[model samples]
Target: MTQTASPLPERGPTGRRTAKGSLAAKSAQRVERPAPLRQVVYDALAELIINRTLEPGQHLVEADLAEYLGVSRQPVREALQRLQTEGWVDLRPAQGAFVHMPTDEEADQLLGVRAVLETHSARLAAGCASEAHVARLWELQNAGLEALAADDGEALVTANADLHSFLTELTGNAVLAELIGLVDRRVRWYYTPIARPRGHDAWAEHAELIEAVAAHDVEKAEKIMAHHTERTRQAFHERPEAARE
Candidate 1:
């Protein structure tokens, strides 16, 4: 005679496995939803570095970071390695990790390339931006002005980036947008230190730039963007903290 198959595990009223089920099988079925420890650590440390919470050239010890982040040294070490590869941290052979200090030349080169890309973006945006795009640009401009008035440097910087990134998207050039995005984070890091000083002037320039785009004046839009980005490049060089090697 054929034997009957064993009954499948039963579920409780709560929809979980009953006590009769194997705990190991239940545990195995549960998947952790959070990011891996290493990525979490990397993101935390990167934010600190970008926002200047972890200043450039400051030494980073794995143990201290691990303790601060409530993790073990393994994840911290992994994070630092990844940060180094991404140019956010520099790992010396025996000296450990330090925040990467961007040189003036590096800043100039990146900003120069940014200005070129963004000038073209503005030219395209002037012709292509719809009434809705111009309205969004005005909204971002007002947000930046409000942030400046409130002395919220972080919010101002975010608004500034949002406005530019939106304009870049309006360019309708995927390749150009990708190139700008590649340098965007580093540009933000550079800009954060000078956000307060640059706040008023930057937003004012944004107002004129928006007008040019809204008028669909390609030449005026391109000129205003070039000037705006160049002024930012100059402001970065003028900051005292940026003088540090």
Candidate 2:
């Protein structure tokens, strides 16, 4: 009867029109491939631990992490393995992973090692530091002071890390640099909860250390660096929050 508009061009089973025009405007949509699944998991979990998003001694379930991160057990397993290597996590047989907590004694030992490494670092810096190196360290030191004055704990920590890394590089020995970097990471874990360090005192100390390095006064630089580590260690040891651990 009425020609039926040529049967309205029949539809697909799901009511999509069976025509080129209904398929796509130009091409099929392509999903963006994600990053390496293991990297994704490792970085995500590492950040969680570093930021204290996961509390010390909290159990980490592979299944839960896999589900939460939208990956499978494979990535989670790899990530946990990496965290264990970094000493940020512990894997107990059949007990699952837990965030690692270092005791005061362990912290003290790490800080002691840091002191030695950085003292040698300061000595080397005094021996061969360029004016530019000194300038750069000074810039970072000033920035760190400003961060502390503003009561910006996170910013101060980041700036402090930068200054330390700069000194590590300036030490000119790759081995010493590596050792300093390792200790630096350990130090920050304990330093985070401590109060904002006094900016002027810190800057003054840095300035004195820089001058000592510039003059190649190895003894002065070494002594200052040692005192700096000792002060930091004492502060951290007395910090009430650190006591909680």
Candidate 3:
């Protein structure tokens, strides 16, 4: 007599093994498509911290983060570790993680460095920017103006970042671009809270800087950019209460 054959096991939509699959099959599937849960958690936590949703000095409970992110505690722990390395979080032994509270000196130093890099970028952009690049700068300038007029703080901040990033790109220096990119996020975090108070004057300065760049006046562009960044740094220091709040 012929014996009855066992039916095939059910597979996932991607034809990967189901929970009932053999350990070897499951391991192979995980290897083929490694989960990026830690990275996802890291990005989410970073965004929250940068936007001040997770305020400086705020405690970061791994379990709470895992629950909030719909992830396991392991990924949250790994993400927090990475954030600590990047200066976004501070890990304390037995006390858990806390959002990093940047000191006044740290802010000043970083902004000063940004001023130097941006001034050089603006000068290079003035020399190398084509007509098309100038036109794009005008477009970003207009977008920033619109954001200001609408009193949209987030949009204004984003527009400001985009304009600066475009200028760096115009310089055609990959190394310079990379360095600016590294610092740009923290700069934006610092700038976001002050975006509204600084809106009108900032956009006007951007207009003048754009014009200088359009004219290919390297010295003028550098001077304007230097002044522009310095003003922002001063504004941040002047509004300490606003930044803390």
| lDDT at residue 118 of model 2 (Cα atoms) | 84
The 10 consecutive residues of candidate 1 with the worst lDDT sum are 8-17
Candidate 1's C-alpha lDDT?
A: 0.84
Off by over 4 Å in 1: 1-35, 241-245
Displacement of residue 176 (Cα, Å) in model 3 is 0.7
What is the C-alpha lDDT profile of model 2 across 69-168, one tens digit per residue? 6667898899899999989898888666877876779878988998898888888889889889888888887888788778887677678778878887
Model 3: per-residue Cα lDDT over 147-225, one tens digit each: 9989998889889999999999989999999999999989988888889888988999999999999999999999999
Best by TM-score: 3
* Count of residue pairs whose backbone atoms collide, per candidate: 0, 0, 0
The worst-scoring run of ten residues by lDDT in candidate 3 lies at 8-17
Clashes in model 2: which pairs?
A: none
Better of 1 and 3 by TM-score: 3
Candidate 3 residue 156 C-alpha distance from true site, Å: 1.7
